[model samples]
Target: MIETIVFDVGETITRDDRYWASWADWLDIPRHTLSALVGAVVAQGRDNADALRLARPGIDVAAEYHAREAAGRGEHLDESDLYDDVRPALSSLRDLGTRVIIAGNQTSRAGELLRGLDLPADLVVTSGEWGVAKPQPEFFQRVLEVAQAAPRRTLYVGDHPVNDTFPAKAAGLRTAHIRRGPWGHLWADDPKVMEASDWRIDSLTQLTTLIEG
Candidate 1:
């Protein structure tokens, strides 16, 4: 029986479009510059790791982000709210005897957003705190350890195949592919990859039934 769940935050529980849309505006950098930098790092082309390895780095983006959350910022930048089904679905799962945990690369900025909202997270593991990012296999392992769950009995759900599905699949955890727009093309229609997921849902509302099954 499924007993635990390790969820990703950004696109999973929390709606992230608002914060991202305003990140460049607050940084005083052109959106294009920020986009290029993030794109380089995300695409693994510019070598952010190399840059950090060269220097211990005085600034931590995650830390600054946490501080921002503590300061009660991001409200002005944010407009849209979290998904309506997220909390009720999670609550239903918890009521069904599932212990839901969080595993993501986000800073504790998640706490800031979530503290005000009525959400439930049994335990949380983050890349900022774990020193490792998703799809690394170890990320899910840590979550399993923290949640006292065996991979065979737990499910890891997230919006990305490479970041969420690949690692959880390798770690022996069941997987749920949350298909969203934006990155849908690279993965959405690929039958081979889609076949790998235990379940695929385009909306969080579908989770209630998927998990119930």
Candidate 2:
């Protein structure tokens, strides 16, 4: 039985594409360019530090993520509109006997973004707090410890195959890929994710059936 359901923050639940698109200038790249960099980082098996070198520092990536949400009369709105089915869906999962949590790459600004949205999160695993990014086994270990969960008993869901799915699987968690969008343009392909994810879906609505089946 799956006792815990963990999520990758940006795309998995937060609709990250819109958020990041607003702040693309800081990274000095186009949407496609940033996507290429992420892909290359994953393909080369670079750690978070290495990824940072490619992206550069001092740009406040977190604030940029929030800026998009707060921009232009807030058509999309703040984190409040992150995922249309977020709170209700996660709450439903909790009602069905699963604990829900968020594992994200967030700094203070990122935290502020989430707060502005009024997200009801049980636990958060952040890169700023941990000093590491996901897809690293150590990051998963920390998550398991914080949740007081055994990897085997957990279900991890993420958008990226390279970072979220592969590492989560390696850490012994059952993995799922929420492949709603074309992530291929954004992240490099990794065999580890290519080989080991237990399930893949274009929507979280498909997840419950997979977990129960």
Task: Give candidate 1 regions above 4 Å deviation.
Answer: 27-80, 184-186
Residue 152 of model 1 has an lDDT of 78
TM-score of each: 0.73, 0.70
Per-residue lDDT tens digits for candidate 2, residues 11-40, read: 677765664444345455686766566556
lDDT of predicted model 1:
0.66
Q: Write the per-residue lDDT of candidate 1 for residues 71-132, one digit (tens) a residue.
A: 76544312245666677777888888889887786645445445446466686556867877
Clashes of 2: 2
Q: Which ranges in model 2 have alpha carbons more than 4 Å from their true place? A: 25-77, 184-194
> Which pairs clash inside model 1?
none
Local distance difference test values of all predictions, in order: 0.66, 0.66
Q: How does residue 46 of candidate 2 score in lDDT?
A: 62
Model 2 steric clash pairs: 39-188, 80-117
